[model samples]
Target: MIQNNLEKYTIQLPKKLNFVLKKIDSNSNGIVFITNLENKLIGSLSDGDIRRGMMKNQVTKYVNINSKYINKKPFFLNYNSDVKKILSYLESKKNKKKYKCIPLVDNKKVIQDISTIESLRKYPIINLKIDNSEINNVIDAMKSGWISSAGSFVSQFEENFSKYLGGGYSITTTSGTTALELALKSLQIGLGDEVILPNLSFAASINSIINVGAKPVVVDVNPKTWTIDCNRILEKISSKTKAIMPVHIYGQPCEMDKIKKIAKSKNIYIVEDAAEALGATYKNAKIGLHGDCSCFSFYANKTITTGEGGMVVFKKKKYFKLANQIKNHGMSRKKFYFHETVGSNYRMTNIQAAIGISQLKKIKSLILSRRRIFQYYNKRLRKFNYINLLPENNWSTNSYWLYTILIKNLGTKKREKLIKNLLKKGIETRPAFYPFNSMNIYKKYCSGSYKFSEKIANNSISLPSTSISHYDQDLIIDILIKEINKLI
Candidate 1:
C-alpha cells in the first residue's frame, strides 16, 4: 500500500487551527484537504495558509480553520476530465509550490482522492515487490564483487526454485522470453515445427516461438479462463506440430490436465508459460509440474521479482542439462571454453538471483495478499451486472496476478475512456493484452479465428491490484461505479 506517503490523508471542516497547523506541518506534503459533513471537498489549507491566517486573526493555533482561513475554491478536477488538462493545471500550480497535491473530485464535489507526485511515485501500476531483505542481499552480493552470471546465488536460486515448483530441476535465464527460447531449443523445435498457443497472451510467447524459427499456431481462448481453449488446441495440431505452449494468463492456470493428456497421446512436448502464474496451482498440484518445461518470469511486477530474470523448470534432469547447454553457448560440459553447437548467452546474474531468493521466500504471502485483494474487489464488483471479474475455478488456484474484469457492452474505445477516467483520479489501470492476431506485427504469424480472444481483449480491464491500500481500492471502485453509472 506504500503507507508512508499518507495517500488517504484528509481533514474535516469545523476543525480548529491547532489541528490544522499540526496536520499541515505533519502531512507528507505540507497540505490537507478540507471536507464538509458528507466528506465532500470544500477547500484546502496549506502550511503557509495556516501561518498567514493565524497572523491575520491575531490568534494562536486554537482558532477554527473555516473562519476565514480555508481556500474554499481550491483547485480540483472532475474525475472524468481530460488527464492532460489536470496535469497541466497541476504543473502550473507547482511553481507556487502551493499545490503539490491536487484533489480529484466527482461531480457531487466529493473528494475521490488526492494526487501527489510523491504519492504517485510511491505507488505505481504494479509496484516493485522488493523489500529490505532483497536490498540487503543485493548489497552483500555487490560487496563480494561477484555481480555477474557465475555466482553461488544463481545456482542456489535455481535449486530452491526447482524445489518450490515441486521437485523439478531449473535453469536460470536472463528473461522469461529467453527461458521459453531455451526450452523450445531444448525440445529441438525449430524451422519445420509448429507450436500451438493461445492468442490471449503477451507477445513474448509468440516471439519465443518465432525466435526459435518455429511457426506459431494461434488458437482462441476460453472467455471464462482467459486461457487457450483445450478443445481448440488439439485441432490446431498438425504432423508438423512439435509442442504446445499453454500460457497461464493473468495468474489463472490453463486446463493443463486436458492439454497434457492430448499432448501425451500425440507425443507432443508441452511448454507451460507459467510466467504470470507463479505460486498458482492446477488441481492442488503446482502448474510447472504438468509441462515438460515451465517458464516463469521475475519481471519487477511479477508475484516475485529478480528485477530482470526468468527460470525454466523441468521434471527431467536430461531436459535441464539440455536447457543449460542451450543457454550457455552450447558448450560441452567436460571441455573448458569448448563449443559443441550454436547457442545464446542467456544466463541470469547472481545479483538478480539473490533478489529472487529473497522475493521467493515471501511468494506465499505475496500470492495470498493478491488473492485477498481479489476477494475484496470481487465482493464489490459482483453487484454490478455489467462487470465480470476473473474467477478462481475449481480446477485451478489463481494467484490473482492482475485482478482483471470485463465491462459488458463496452467496446475498446469506451473501455479506454473508462481507463482515462480512472487515470484522471491518479488510479492506474491497464487494458487486456490484444490478441496476437489483432497485432499487426504478429498478424502474419497468426492465421486463425480469434473472435473470443479479440472480444475479451477489447472489453477487459486489469484493475489495480498487487500490494495496494484497501482505502485506495475503495476510492477506485467508488470512482469506477460513478463513472460507469454515467456511461450507462
Candidate 2:
C-alpha cells in the first residue's frame, strides 16, 4: 500500500449502517475497515455488503462488529509485508475475482494501511528514475523564465551529449522523428532519392524517409543480430539510393564496418536511426559516431528522458550548420526574422534540456543497470528451450533498452495471447515492431520477402526492464514461465 494515510478507510465498530455507507462513499476505493476499541481490525465492509445487510435486516438502523454482513474472513497481509509477498497474494487464484483491495494488519490485528489492486499489481514496461537533481534543474529553468528554446541549459545539454559520444557536432530537436527529418533535409536527400533501411524498426524510421520525399527501400534483418542485413544492401542499391539507414534495433548495434564499407564504395550517405541505441557501441565506438549523421530520442521510455526531445549528431560542420538553421524555422543566424530556407518548428525547449542535463550525468550508471537486467534475464531464461534470448554479439555492446525474447515456433496469434494473459496478471509486455511493408501506407515499398523480419515481429516480446526491482523481476518471470508453459 506504499505506507499511505489510512484514517479515511478505518472506522470503529458501534456505528450505524448508514454511517458505514458514508465512510465507504468518502473513500475512493469503495471500502471501509471496521476495527475494535483497541484499533484491532475485526472485519471489512463494502457497498455490496451494506446493500445485502440492508435487505437481510429489513433496513436495520444500527450495525455492530458482530453483524452478519461484516466479513470477518477478509483477505489481508502483514503490515511489514514486502513487495513480493503483496504481489503473490494479489496474483493468487483464490483472490483473483474476489478482492480488489487488501488490508495490511499487524500481529495484533490492528489495521495499518490499505493496498489496492492498482497499487500492488502495477508493473510497467518502463519507469523513469527521477531524483532531486532533475527536479531542481527544471525548477531553476522555470525560475529563470527562459523556458522556451533559448537558454544556457540548451547549449550545455548539447555540449555534454556531444562530449559523451566522444565529440561530434550536435543539435537538439523537438523529437527523434524531427531529428531524422532534419538529418535527411540537411544532406539534401529528398525527391528522386531513395534510403535503404531494415524492415524491423519503429515506424518513425520509415516515416522520416517518406516525410523527406524519399522512397524507403526496405530490406530484411539478420536472424542473429536482428539488425539490417549488410549482405543484402548491395542488391537493393541503385543510382537513386542516397543513404543507408541502419537502425540499432533494441539497442543492438548493426554491423557498421560492413555497412560503412558499402556506403563508401557506392558514394552513398549514412544516416543512423540511433533512437533506441544511445550509450550502445559498435566495436568500441559509440553508436552515433559511425554514420554521416545520427539521430537519438529522449522520449519518456528512453534510457534518458527529457519528457520529449531528441538530438542529431553530425560528422561534418557543414551538415551541423545546415541542420541548425532548419531546426529553428530556417531563420538566418546573422539576421533577425530573415528566412534562409523553408523549415518547420523543430526546436527543443530549454526546460526539456535542463532535465536532459541532469539525466546525462547518470547515463553511465543507467546503461549499466539495463545491461545487468539483460544478463539476469538471460541467465534465468536460457535453460528454457522455447525462447531465444536477446543478441549480444562479440563486436557489439547492447544497452538492452528492453529485455526482448523470441518464443520459438510460436505464431502471431499464440504470442498475442501470451501477451494478453501476462497483461491480465499485471505484467506488461510489448510486441516487437511490425515490418514496415506490413502497414497499408508502406505496402508499396515491399521489394522482397522479409521472412526474418516478419518472423521476429510475430514471435518477439519485450519484457519490463527499466527501474524494476529484483522482486518485481522475479514476479514477472514466474508468471511469464507459467503462462508460456500453458500455451505449449
Candidate 3:
C-alpha cells in the first residue's frame, strides 16, 4: 500500500482457484486482487471466498477465475483521489465491512497501487498547522529587508507575547535553550551556584544550568503529575543553591504555590521551564506570571511556533533590560559598538518573529485544539482499566502539549515493543524522557533514588497530540489498543 512491490497481492485472472488461495496466503493481508491480461483490475479474491467456493464445490482448486467466488464489484478509489476522499470511503456508513485495504486505480481502472489504512497518511506525533498569515508575514519581512534581528517584528512579538502573559517584559531568543541560558546569565546565577530541577525532563532544562557554569542538582518528579516533586526541593538545596528550575512537563503546570513558598523561604529564584506550556495556568493565573523568569519554546511542535525560536519573560524590569543587552552581545544601547559585558549571540531573527506574531494571533484556538485532543483521548482511554491518563488537576489547566498515558504493569521493554508495533501500523509515539541521573553523564548529579521518574520513563507513551482529525485519532486508538494488548 505504500508504493512498494505489490506483486504478491496480485494475480492473473486466468489463474486457478488454488493459485488465488496461495497468493492470498502469501500476501500480508488475506486478500488478492485479480487483473486481466492488460493488468486492469477485474475482481478481488480472499481466503474466505476460496473457503466458500470449496464448500460449494468438490473440485474448487480446479475451478477457473470466472466462478462466483471472486468479488467483481470491489470497492476502490481513483489514483488522483485525495486523503479526504480516501478517508470518506474508509469511514463510509454504506459499507458494512470496514475496509482495511483499498486498491488505487488509474482512470481506466488499471490497478496503479494499493491504499491501506496506513498509506492514507503517516500520522506524526506532532503536526504543524500553518495557514496563510504566517507565510505572508514571512514574505513581507523578507521583502522589507528586515529578515535580521533588527526589524520591528522582534519587539512587536516580545510586546505581544508579554501582554499575552498578563503584562511582563519579554526577550526573544534563538531557542528555548538560549532563553534559559540568558535567564540564568541575567540573574547572575553562575560559577559556584547550583540549580535544583526535576530529573524527568528534556535535556535542555539541565543543560542550560551546566552551560552557565552552574551545577545541576537533579531531583525526582511527582508520580501523578510528572512534575518536579516539591517535597524533594529542600532536601537537594544547599548554600550554593541559587534557583529551583521547575519544568511544566507536557504542558501541565507545576504546583506553583508550593514551589513559590519554597523559593521564598530559601531566598532562591524560580526559573520556570514553561517551554511546552504556553497557555497553561495555575490557580487561574497563567504559568509565566508565577516565576521570576519563565522561558518558552516556539519549536515546530509547540502550541505556537516560529519554526526555531523562543521567548523569556521576566517579572522585573532590571532583569529584562540586562537580558536584552546580553541577548545582543551585551552592546550598550546609548553608545553603538561599546561593549558593556561579554555575551553570546542569542537573538531571534525578524522573520521568525513575524511568523511568531501570526501564530500568536491564533493562539487561543490552538490552545483549544490541544485541549480538545486531550479530551478526546481521555474520553476514549478512560474505559481501559490498564491506562493512566495525563493529569489535569482541578487547580490547574493543562495545555496538553502531548496526550501521554501510562500502561499499568508495563515495563520498559514491553513499552518499547508497543511503540515499535504502533510505528508499523503508521502511528507515531514518544517514550517519556529518560531520567537525567540514569545517564552516565549526569551520574555526578544523582544524589537519591528516582523510583517514580524511572517508572514513568519506563511505561509512559506520548501519542500524537497535534490538530489531527477525530478519524485519525480513532485509528490511533484502535491500533494502540490492539498493539498494547498484544505486547502486554
Candidate 4:
C-alpha cells in the first residue's frame, strides 16, 4: 500500500551557517541546505543568498558574518499536503519577493533537502529505446547489402507522411533546421533575398534563413495568437523579397490561406516553418500542404520523438530531387564524385527513422492529449481577470504545444515575486522569451516598431507542458490565482 502522511524533520538554524562555510571551502560556493539542531527541520539557503548577503555587507572576501540571511527562511511544505495547497501558499509569497528553489519540509518544521518540484513530485522517467522496431521490413534491403541510405523504412516513412499530409513528397533530413535550409536553398532564395516571419519564434528559424545566405525580416506577432500578421506582410514585401517563411508556432497553424494568397499575388515562394505545427490544419488542409515546402521537427520534445530528426514535404517531384541532393553534399548520382551544386551533409540515420515510424503512428493520440491539457488550463485560468489565454482563430485548430498566458500590468518586481512564491511551494515556472529585436545579435538587423512583442516578452509565462499527468497542473493554477488575487 502507498502512504501519503506527513513525516517529521528538524533544522539546526546555527549549524546551517557552518555547513555553508564548509561547502564553500570544498569549492561548492553555491550549494546551500537546511537542518535543525539535531539537523532536523530547518530551512535551506543558497549561493545566491550568500553572494547577495556578502555584497550587501560590503564583504568582498569570504568572512563569517552573523546575518539573518544565512539562516534565511525557505519556501517549503509538508510532503503529504495537497500539492495545490502548498503552491497557493508559495504564490502568495512570490507575488511580493524574489527567490529560487523552495525546499520540501515535513512536519516539525524540518527541511527534507529536496529542492525541485520534479524531485518532490517524482515524475516518471521516459525510457528511451533508440532502435527497437520492426527491422524485417528492411530485410530485403539488408540482404542486398544496401543498408547505408537506401533502406525501405526511409522510403516508406517518407511516402506515408507525404500521403498523410496530402499529395506532398517527403524529403527527410538529419535535423529540422537543415530541412528549412534545404527548402530555402531548393527555391534558390539566397544572399539578397529577404523572408518575413514573427519575432516570437525558435532560434532554428533564424539559423535556417542565415544558412541559405538570406536576411530574416522579423515582424511583431499578432497579440492574439503570437503569429505573424498576414496583412502586415504586404508592407514588408519588396522586390528583394524572394520568399516568406511563416512559422506555425506552438503547434498552432498560422493563417496560411491568407499568407498563400499574398505570396501568389506577389509571385513569391512560401516555405512553411511547420516545426511546431505538425498535425495542425488551416482551412481543411495541413500547413505543410499549403506551402511550396514545409519543414517538420522530430526531436524528442516534439509531438513525435525520433531522437534527432526532421523532414521537408512539398508537392513537386522536382523540388524533392533538389532537396535530396542538397541534403547529401550537393551530389546527384552515387559512385561519381561530380558535384552539381554547393551542399552540406544532413541525412537522418536509419535508426532515427525507425523510432520516427513508431512515433508517427502515435501522433494523433499525442496531439489529442496536448489539446485536452490546454483546454483544462483554459477552463480553470479563464476566471482570472488579468490573465489572457491564447486566442483561437476560425481558420485553424490549435495543437497547443505550450499553455501560455499574459498578465496585464505585470511588472518585473511582481513577476519575480510570483515566480519565487511559486518556487517556494514546489511549483516550477518559466518566463516568455525576450523580443528578438531586444537580443544583442539582431539589434542591427531588425528595424521597426515591436511594442506588441515587447509587451508579451515582459508579461508572458510558459507553464509546465510535458506530456504527463495533471498532478502539478492544478497546483499551478491555484498558485497563479493566489498571486493575481494579491495584486488586486
**Best model number under lDDT:** 2
Model 2, residue 352: displacement in angstroms? 0.4
Model 4 agreement with the true structure over 334-362: per-residue lDDT tens digits:
65677898888888766556667767776
* Best candidate according to TM-score: 2
Tell me how far the alpha carbon of residue 416 in candidate 2 is from the true structure, in angstroms, after superposition.
Answer: 1.7
Whole-model alpha-carbon lDDT for candidate 2 = 0.87
Worst 10 residues of 1 by lDDT: 1-10
**Higher lDDT: candidate 2 or 3?**
2
Off by over 4 Å in 2: 1-82, 85-120
lDDT of 3 at 190: 96
My TM-score estimates for the predictions, one after another, are 0.78, 0.82, 0.80, 0.71
Model 3 TM-score, all chains together: 0.80
| Candidate models: Cα lDDT each | 0.81, 0.87, 0.86, 0.70
The deviation in Å at residue 363 for candidate 3 is 0.7
Q: Candidate 1 regions off by >4 Å?
A: 1-123
* Candidate 3 ranges beyond 4 A from true positions: 1-114, 117-119
Q: Taking the tens digit of each residue's C-alpha lDDT, what string does model 3 give over 119-182?
A: 6655678867777899999999999999899999999999999889997899999999999999
lDDT of 2 by residue, 1-488 (tens): 12254777888878877787888988777788878889888788888887887788744678786678878877788755766667566666544545567887777788866767665544568756788899999999999999999999999999999999998899999999999999999999999999999999999999999999999999999998999999889999999999999999999999999999999999999999999999998888889999999999999999899989999999999999989999888999999899898878899999999999999999999998888778888888999998988876789898679899999878778889998888777677889998887888998987888999998998899998876667667778888999998997
